[model samples]
Target: MVSIDEVARAAGVSTATVSRALSGRGQVSAGTRSRVLDTAAALGYVVSAPASSLASGRARNIGVLLPVVDRWYFSTVLAGIASGLQSAGYDITLYALTEDPTERAVVFETFLRRRRVDGVIAIAMSLDTAEADRLAALGMPVVALGAEHRQLPSLAVDDIAVAKLATAHLTDLGHRELAHIGILHDVDDGTEREHIPSLRRRGFEQALDAAGIPRTSARHEHGDFTIEGGHAAAMRLLTGDAPPTAIFAASDEMAFGALIAARDLGLSVPGELSVVGVDGHELSGFFGLTTVDQFPHDQGLRAAREVLAALDEPAPPTTPETGPAGLDPLPFDLVVRTSTRPPRRES
Candidate 1:
């Protein structure tokens, strides 16, 4: 009996394409589909299943694991993933994961082992050794975003550097008194290196220290990465004695909240208060807030494409797990707007 891989190689396409072409369940150009048909007939290849199920050697679907569904950044990334997968004639099976040990194990051991998906894409949800072992055992492609996994490929932004850039912007503008708004420990991959909020905070402090400023002289507050949380944090910072001249929010939502807090306090932006944030949120320009644009949606698309491209390649033999290569860095940039400027002279 000939294998699906043989037919795919002879047809000059991926097994997924062969499955799609044979099952007529996914997008395939008429010419390519015809060619696949001719090649299969010539090779005496026969379809084991009609609807491209696991028996067909391709599921025409991918599993997407996410840490959160409600947040803007996550939602945006999910949309991009969905868009990329759909355009490629594939569907997605969504899984929302948590810290629950049993639940996590069920996903990796049971649900995924069922093999309904051709591959897996995990966004902002890190997998540990056991979990990575289980996934690796599945013999399918896996891609991670935001959260990095040592055993598998990952794409993530340099959070520490992103934060450093945001903070450095404020410092470069001659703003000495700085405040940072973001709660620590939002998400921790097994490495602890990808812990989002904590990394940003470390970046903030690093930037301050580099500027010959005492770390203790700067203010730190928990913003929960939300508008309300940011507003409350900023309110406390702005209302207190000797408030900061600049605020660097870990996220754009929090930065918007800071902007609101400044307005409510009757502080003139770029004069009495300057605020910057990470994440190039849609409203960043509308609010005139400077930010680091990490391109979350593009990040999602890239992750999706990584898994898809992997599908078209032959499976590599199992090898020893590579040690601590570190997470792959995604691109980011500092987007300056009207929200920041050198503080006006008191004289």
Candidate 2:
């Protein structure tokens, strides 16, 4: 295997300089850094984790713990994190804990505690106090994405406020009877069933109450966070005796399903019922669903950056504080389209 020394010799720089250049740390001149990188690339030189750790006291990799790899939001966030970490000269190790208790235990108790990564970035998983304690015991910096952790630094949007914003948009259109389609996930994944749905539901209720509309239990239905689930739930809701004039889905996928349900029921969208969704999914524009754009990709990028920042510190805090991590809330914009309008009177 091509060693760092060989690359350093080929680039006419010292081994220390090669390390600095390849790691993008310390004081390496741009010209020398470029030369070292070019030589290493040409020689197929891969950095030795053991050697690098000996020198820098860090593994130069970050662990990204996610609930599922197949989901769109998770994958998009992972892409952003990977991009940001790569730019910062760090490697990412992905761990998917798909609701298996044993696997989750192994990951938290063994793999994470093994010092394989300098820090961790948990996406969309709400760590319980025990899990948070385990991570804290590892003495590495940890940052959470899409969920708040008062005991550790976290980056997330205020879900409740976003829900209120979405619901308010429909109410402003003079929608008196509105319905909400929410996702029901396992509590372990820390979304939908964990906190997002409840917070969003509360926000929806608050918005309706503020508008002097009665918040009835009949207006809500829970389903998985998939388009099919939304479709099924919405079909049932719309077919009921009292159909709502507007539907506020917690996610774009669900909103798409609501649209499908509306079509299947022979209802004219925005004429018979208006629909709104959250998450700004890429396909929202194609369907023309009015939505609250919560930049998930940007959220991932910010979470990765926070991990890098903690890694860069001279001495990371051993005891994680239960306080705001000073991360800015990602901006949200309401994208209006043909899917939403004021209620039309029946002829």
Candidate 3:
């Protein structure tokens, strides 16, 4: 491998001058910096990360905390973070926190304190007061995605708005009796309940209430936010004596399941059962499912930008919010498709 010293020699500059030019850290004349850069590019010279870190007192690596990596939303958001951070010249290290409290304690208390990363970006993981305190004590920049922390900066899609938009789409199609497939709010895993699901469920209810729909006509069923879970929940709703004219699922995956359930029961979509969902999943277009698009990938991009900004500005800028930064709300839109329409009158 070509060394920086070789590039410095080729550029007729000192090693220190080459280092300053390459790292963009110290004072180097514009002409010398440009010449050194050109020589380094020609020589394929690369700086060692450890050496750079030692010199700058920055690891130049970001730790990303995730609850799980298997889901579509999580994976897409991660992809965005990886791409953004890579372009910004930073390495990424993933820290998956399980539901096990013991393991979480080890990660937050031990691993994170090792000075391995300059900052952190947490995705959809609930942090307790103690955990938040520990992160704050790290004195590293922290950004959150898809969840909230009173002490950290965050970027997330408004789940309630997503649900309300989905519900409103069906209602606008002239569907009176509506059913919702969402995650059960009361589920306990020895931590705080997920705020997204509860807010979505409330949004669904609020839309119905605003429409002046009777409480008895507003049907609801809990799902695991998976296709299978949605299928099961949808089966129950579709098989009822007085089935709803339309259904609003909390996620596109669940909406797909509801569509499958409707098909199995020989119900013609838009004629008997109109289905709508949140998240503009890739499969939504194939299935022609109407939905509210909450760009998860974009959320990741914004979250990465926020963390990078915090890292650059180390001192927390004075914001009107209580946290180091405020919540950035992503935009959502109702995408109309073939799966939703006015309910057909019984012949």
Index of the highest-lDDT prediction? 1
Where in model 2 is the C-alpha error above 4 Å?
Answer: 41-44, 183-194, 314-326
Best by TM-score: 3
Against the hidden reference, what TM-scores do the models get? 0.83, 0.90, 0.93
For residues 8-41, could you state the per-residue lDDT of candidate 2 as single tens digits? 8899989989999987779988888889988999
**lDDT-better candidate, 1 vs 3:** 1
TM-score of 2: 0.90
Report the lDDT tens digits of candidate 1 across residue range 167-216.
Answer: 99999899899999998555544543447888899999999988988999
Query: What ranges in model 3 sit over 4 Å off?
Result: 29-31, 187-194, 315-321
How do the residues 1-347 of candidate 3 rate in per-residue lDDT, one tens digit apiece?
99878997899999999888888888999999999988988888888999889888888899999989988878998998988898878899999999788999999989999999999999988787678667777878888788776766667777877888888877777789899998765555433335788889889888888777775678999988889999999999999878889999988999999999999999999788899988888889999999898887887788888778887777554332455656658788898999999998777
Clashing pairs in model 1?
none
Question: Alpha carbon lDDT of residue 172, candidate 3?
Answer: 76
